[model samples]
Target: MTSAAAVASPATVRPSRGLAVFWIVAGLFGVATSFLLYLEYVGQLTGADPIVSCSFSPIVTCGPNLLSPGGNLLGFSNSIIGVVLFWGPVYAGVSSLAAPGGMRRWYWRVYSLFIAGAFLFVHFLAYRSVFEYGSLCPWCMTVWLATIPLFWFTVSWTLREGVWGTGAGTRRVGAAVYSWALLLTVLDYAVIAIAAQLRLDVIGSLF
Candidate 1:
């Protein structure tokens, strides 16, 4: 017979419930889009004519855009990469949600590194699609949109909460991120969107 107080309590981290919720929503959205992209990619590989429903225009076709050389740079569809890559955040988010207790210091650090890689790779692929492929996969763009916030806030929270390490510089930067994360994220997207307009003139070309 075990006493009621004998069982150990579950551990919890210090990050806010809001942060966990943010991780969950953002992670799930990215994963869902990535999964959709993967399905589209698979359809193309299998020679399916009706690959996806959103390919009614030249600049927004999922099939041709994904079948381009850039999509297979790794000898496979980049969406596959996205399917795998977005899971990092998904898992982290789930963990945070289930157990709001903060994760280990090193966990945040490692996540930051992984997201950094993902952030860079996404831009690389985006550039290839924009300039070389002359099109954009809507699903890919969704992943890009989700990833920006994921990376921004992940880094921001890690620094602000001193999850990785404690230091004056880290705290100072973290404070800045906490204050300006949303504005910076919006600005970052705005700059890229503006640049894309300059080169692609998406609206101008559409009309």
Candidate 2:
């Protein structure tokens, strides 16, 4: 006979509904924006005079960025990479929601690493848009918008759920970060907005 206390506990935790929903929405949004940009790039390459939907004005256009060597860093439109990468969060969200035990810790850690890379890459593109290229791509900004929150929330959730570790200090830090995730996301947006305003006078350019 085995004692009740001898049974092993389950290793997996249920995914947060809120975080899962965010992942779905943000991933879909990223995919849409990235696809749009990819289509525009394809049109450009094919020598078609397709009107770019995101090209609102001279200051706010995707033409230069799409045509620039920076956009083809990997010898293809960066948006093509975006189209592929954004699907990861969507799959994670869908599978985690459908699974009884949700996702494993290793899964989240790997996902977080990719998102961290995206966060860094997004900031680099923002820097180029502000200083190097001197034009704003609306679709690129949309991708940035989607990625920023996804990164913050995914990281916060991983921390709060013990994906990073199961220590008291780690949990405490994760909880603290989770509580401030939204405000931090807003602050990130503000940083980009302020930079654009300073370098490009985005508001003045609009008028």
| Top-scoring candidate (lDDT) | 2
Model 1 pairs in collision: 12-101, 13-101, 13-102
Q: Which residue runs of candidate 2 sit more than 4 Å off their true CA positions?
A: 1-10, 47-52
For candidate 1, the lDDT comes to: 0.70
Candidate 2: pairs in clash:
none
Q: lDDT per residue, candidate 2, 1-207, as tens digits?
A: 011111113456556666676788899999989998898887778866655577777778888889998888898899999999999889888876787666666777988999989999999998998899999988889999999988887776676677778788887787777778889999999999999889888878778
Reference-based TM-score, model 1: 0.84
* Candidate 1 per-residue C-alpha lDDT over 1-207 given as tens digits, one digit per residue, 9 for 90 to 100: 011111112221345656666776777788778778888787777866544564646776677668787777788887777767777776876775565345666776888888877777778877877777777677888888988877777777777666656687896797777667778779877876776677677666556
After superposition, the stretches of candidate 1 with alpha carbons farther than 4 Å from their true spots are 1-13, 47-52
Worst 10 residues of 1 by lDDT: 1-10
Model 2 TM: 0.90
lDDT values, one for every candidate: 0.70, 0.81
**Prediction-by-prediction clash tally:** 3, 0
202: Cα error in model 2, Å: 1.3
